[model samples]
Structures are given as C-alpha cells and as structure tokens.
Target: MKLIGSTSSPYVRKVRIVMAEKKLDYRFEAEDVWSEQTQIASSNPLGKVPCLIMEGSEAMFDSRVIVEYLDTLSPVGKLIPQGGRDRAAVKTWEALADGLLDASILARLEATWPSRQANERSQAWIDRQMEKIDLALVAMDKGLGDKPFCSGIHFSLSDIAVGCALGYLDFRFPALDWRARHPALEKLATKLALRQSFTDTLPS
Candidate 1:
C-alpha cells in the first residue's frame, strides 16, 4: 500500500493519523500537487492530495472515504462508531470541522497568492468565514464538553477531524489565539496530541 500526499495538507494529515492509529505498514509517497509532473492527477482525476493507492487496486481519494475504509481494516481502536445516532454525531463533527478547514485553506491561499497582498485581501469575507469557524468551535465545545472524545469516551473520527482543523488554524491563523480563548477545546486538542497517532501526523 502507498499513500500519496504532501505534508502540509490537513486532509493528508488526517489520513496519516488514521494509518498510525491502525498500526498499518504502507509506503508514503509525498507529491507536490502543484507540480506539472505530479502523479496525483493520474491517481486522482480531481488532482487532490491524500490519495491512497492500495497494492493492486484503484487508489482512494477524499479523506472521509479513506478514513472510513481504514476503520474497517482494524478491530482495534475504532475511529468511527459502528452504527447509530452516535455515528451521525461523529460524522457531523467531522463535516463541520472539515468545512472550517476548507474555508480557511481557501482564504489562506488567496491571501498569499503572488499578486495578492494583505492589504488587497477582503477582510470582510475572511471575517465572515472566521465567524463561522468560531461558532463551530463553540458548538463543538458545548456538544462534546464532558466527553473525552467527540462522540463518547472512546476516540473516534470526529476527534481526528477536529484535531486537524484546530491544528490548521494554529498553523495558518496564528493571530487568533484559539487555544487561549477556547480552553475546553484546547484541552481536547492537547489530550489528543499526546496520542502517538496525533503526535506522529502533525502537519508540517
């Protein structure tokens, strides 16, 4: 098995964390998605990062699909619930967190475009996206406040998704001080980081 992605991608980081937690052995092929000669386009028609190529089968793209498949591979430390309302909650968390990351990444790339500058950027749009992100963070804190994990006591895919989202905010929006403002959320992130999965897969 081989995983194709770049280190700086949050979605790739999520897949890497799942692989580590599953204790799976697979070759990692880091590809620069922007390069003209990159293989990502061949493996993934969408030309996306975090494409998982199995030994002799079609590769898997989309972090959600890849992570779900990985959870099925192991009976230990299940990252997603088997089936129930609990599963729905976990998926919802993952969706919201991933959405926040999607918006942030778009805003970040646009801000840093060669012809673009901070002064030329639209603070109004960025602020609106951030408002949504903050609201999601607060909702996550309220919904998963007492639990050790997002869905329950056991760690699930939600934790991985949320952790990656928060990590990206720290990486790209350092001025926000998310940890300080949201201590409960920070605690979750801190605790999750102690796990080998999170520690090993941190974004570069």
Candidate 2:
C-alpha cells in the first residue's frame, strides 16, 4: 500500500492519523497535488491529496474512503464504526469537517491569489461556510457533552475527522477564536491531541 499527499494537507494528515491509530503499515509518497500534473492526479483523476494506491491494483481517492479502507487493515482498533445510526453520525461529522476544509481552502486560495485576481466579492460565501462550521461545532458539542468522544462512548472516526478540522483551523485561521469560544472542544482536543498521531500530523 502507498499513500500520496503533501505533508501540509489536512486531508493527508487525517489519513496519516488513521494509519497510526489502526497500526497499518504503508509506503508514503509525498507530493504536492497542486504543484503540477503528476501520478496522484493520473491515479485518482481527482487531483487531490490522500490518494491511496492499494497493493492489488486498487486506487482509493478521498480521505474518507482511504481512511475507512485502512481501518480494515487491523483488527484491534477500529476507527470507523461498523454500522448503525452511529456510523451515519460518524459519516456526517466527517462530511462536515471535510466541507469546512474545502471552504477554508477556497478562501485561502482566493486570498493568496494576485490582488487583481482576488475575489473579495466572495467574502459572504466564505462567511456562509463559516456559519456552517459554527453550527457543526455546536452540534458536536451537544453530541459530545459529558462524553469521552464523539458518537458516544468510543473514539471513532468522527473524533479524528473533527480533530483534523480543529487542527486545520488552528493552523490556518487562528483568528476564529475556536478554543476560546468552545472550551469543551478545546479540552477535548487538548487531551486527545497529545498522541503522536495528532501531534506529528499537524499542518505545517
């Protein structure tokens, strides 16, 4: 198995965290997906990070799919729930987190472009996305109240997905004041993020 992505990508970091939590072994191919036409784009056709090429000629794209597949590699620790409403909730959390990343990345690219090409008109679009982020945080806090992790009772894939989301915000949009606003999430992330899986995979 081989994973191809850049070190600074949150999606890639999520896969790395899953691999560590599941204790799966694989070769890593670090490439900037946005750099140029490369093997990652050819293999996955999405031109995205965290594309996993399996040994049996299977190419898995998207962090969610890649992480889920990697979780099946080990028996001791399962990152994603097997089935039920719990699994649906985990998938929902992942969707929200990944959506937030997409929105953030768009805003970042819009900001980084040449001033003439910059889309200042899209600030409202980004603001709407931020509102979704806030709503998702509130939902997570309510669902996670007084619990050790999300999805109730176990540290499932939901936790890792949300953790990566929060870490990405910390890395890119520190002005959002996430920790100050959500102390519960702050403590939760602080407690669980100490593991090497979280610490080492932080966005650079």
Candidate 3:
C-alpha cells in the first residue's frame, strides 16, 4: 500500500498512527495538494490527501475509512470494537475529533490561504470555526472525565483521532492554549505522545 499525503495533515497523521499501531507496512508518497502541479485528483476526485493505494491499485480516501479498513486487516492491536454500543461510542468520539479538525483547518485556511484577497477573507467565518473548536474541546474533556481512554479502558481509534486533532492544534494554533483550558485532554495527549506510533507520526 502507498499512502499519499503531506506530513502536515492531521488526517494523514491519524491514518499513519493507526497503521503503526497495527504494525502495517506501507510506502509514503508525499504530495502537496495545494500545489497546482499536484496529481492528487488522479487518485482522489476531491483532491484530498491520505489517499491509500492498495496492492491491486484500488484506492481509499478519507482517513476514517482507511483506518477502519486497516483495523480489519490485522489483529495485532484492535482499535475498533467488533459490535455493540462500544463501537458506536468509539465512532462518536472519532467524529467529534474529526469535527474539531474540520473547524480548525477551515479557520486556518481562512486566515492563511493566499488565494483569497485580504478583503475577501472573513474574520467572522474564522471566529465561527474557532468557536466550534472551543466547544468541541469542552465536550471532549467532559466526555473523557476520569477515563483512561476516550471510549473506555483500552486505547482505541477514539484516542488516535483525538490525538491527531490535538497534535494539529499544537502544530498550527498553539496560541489557542487548549492544554490550559482542558487539562484532561492535555493529559491524554501527553500519554499519547509517549507512544511510538504517535511520536513517529508527529506533524512536521
């Protein structure tokens, strides 16, 4: 398998961490989707990063889809539950974490994308996205109260997704000071950082 994405993408990092935890091997193809010369559209119609090319040349886009498929490939370290409410809970945590990433990335693009003229940029839109991130953090911290992991006792996909999101914030929006606001998440991130999977995939 070949993973096509930039190191800076949180979604890509999430997939990488999942693969690492599962002890899967794959080639990394770095691509800058933002560049006009990028060939991302050949693999992904949406021109998104983290497109996985399987052995037979089949393609899988979207980090959530890729990670779930990867968990089924090997039982080395099951990240998703087989069935029941536990599966739903883990998926919910993943959605929340991804949503946070969505908001933060949108806010970042609004503020930093060079394609948009200064007058075209909307501070209001950026503020709204930031607000979503803030609310998501509060909910994540509350949901994680006194738990060893986001979903339950075992470290799962929930923690992987949340860790990637927090790592992105640290890489792009450090001034947000999320750690101070949500100490529980900070603790979780600290623990995650110690993992070889998380450490190896840290965004450059």
Candidate 4:
C-alpha cells in the first residue's frame, strides 16, 4: 500500500496520522497535485491529494473515506468507534473539523488572489468564511468542554481530525491566534503534539 500527497495538506496529514496510529506501513509519495506531472487525476477525478493506492485494489480518494477504510484494516489503535451513536458522534466531529478546514482553505485561497480581495463582494465572501472559522473555533472549544479528548476518555478520530485542522491553521494562518481564544483547544493541541504520529507528520 502507498499514500500520495503533499506534507502541507491538512487532509493528507489526517490520513497520515491515522496510518501512523494504526502502525500501517506504506510508502509515502509526495505528489504536488497542482503540478502538471501529477497523476492525481487518474486516481481521483477531482485531482485531490491524499490518494491511497493498494497493490491490487483501486485507489481510494478523500481523507474521510481513506481513513475510515484504513481504520477497519486494523484493530490496534482504532481511531473510529465500531458502530451505533458513538460512531455517529465521531463522524459528526470529523464533519465539523473537516468543514472548518474547507472554509479556511477557501478563505486563504481567496486572500491569495489579489483581484478577488479588491472586489467588495468577493472580499465579503472571504470574510464570511473567516467568520465561519471563528464560530467553529468557539463551538469546538465548547464541544470539547472538559473532556481530555474530543470523544472523552480514549483518543479517537475526533481528536485526529480536529488536531490536524488546528495544526493547519497554525501553519497557514499563524496570525489567527486560536490558542488565545480557546485555551482548552490549546491544551488539546499540546497533548496531541506529543504523540509520535503527530510529531513525525508535522507539516513543513
């Protein structure tokens, strides 16, 4: 098995973290999807990163699908709950975290396009996304509450997804200062950073 993605992508990082936690061995191929030479389109029509390729099976796309499939392959460090309401809760957490990342990336991309920034309407759209991120941060802080991890007690996919989202914010939007606004999230990030999986896969 092998994974193809860039280190800077939060989506890719989430998949990598799950792979590490599960102790799954696979070749990490760094592919720049933006590059003309990238084979991303072959595996994923959307030309996205974090495509997982198995020896004989079809390649898997999307971090959520890939991670969920990988979780089933090993019971060792099960990041996802087996089933029931528990599984749904973890999936909900993942949706929120991933949605936060999606919004953040859109805003950042819009900011990079100076012409878009100059347009009042486009700028307003960007602002809306930023506001979404702010609200998501507050919700994440409150959702976490006093739990050690997102789901409480054992560390799960909720932690991995949220941790990667926070890490991406730090890497791309350092001025956001999420830590100052959410101290509980700060501690969660601190604890997650200590994990070998996180340390090994820290975005450059």
What TM-score goes with each of the models?
Answer: 0.93, 0.91, 0.98, 0.95
**Candidate 1 residue spans exceeding 4 A from truth:** 117-120
**What are the RMSDs of all candidates, in order?**
1.5, 1.9, 0.7, 1.6
* Ranking of candidates on lDDT, top first: 3, 4, 1, 2
Clashing pairs in 1: none
Residue 102 deviation, candidate 4, in Å? 0.2
Model 3 clash pairs are none
TM-score of 4: 0.95
**Whole-model alpha-carbon lDDT for candidate 1:** 0.87
TM-score of model number 2: 0.91
Worst 10-residue lDDT window, candidate 4? 113-122
- Model 2 regions more than 4 Å off: 115-121
At residue 119, what lDDT does model 2 achieve? 46
lDDT of 2 by residue, 1-204 (tens): 888888889899999999988888888898876665566767878788888888786889889888887888788578777889877888998897788788777777656656545545576766776787788777767767887887777887888888988888888888988888777788779977788889878787
Q: Which wins on lDDT, candidate 2 or candidate 4?
A: 4
Comparison by TM-score, 2 against 4, better one: 4
- Stronger candidate by lDDT (3 vs 4): 3
Q: By lDDT, who's the top model here?
A: 3
- CA lDDT scores, all candidates in order: 0.87, 0.81, 0.96, 0.93
**TM-score ranking, best first:** 3, 4, 1, 2
Model 2 collision count: 0
Please report the candidate that would top TM-score against the real structure.
3
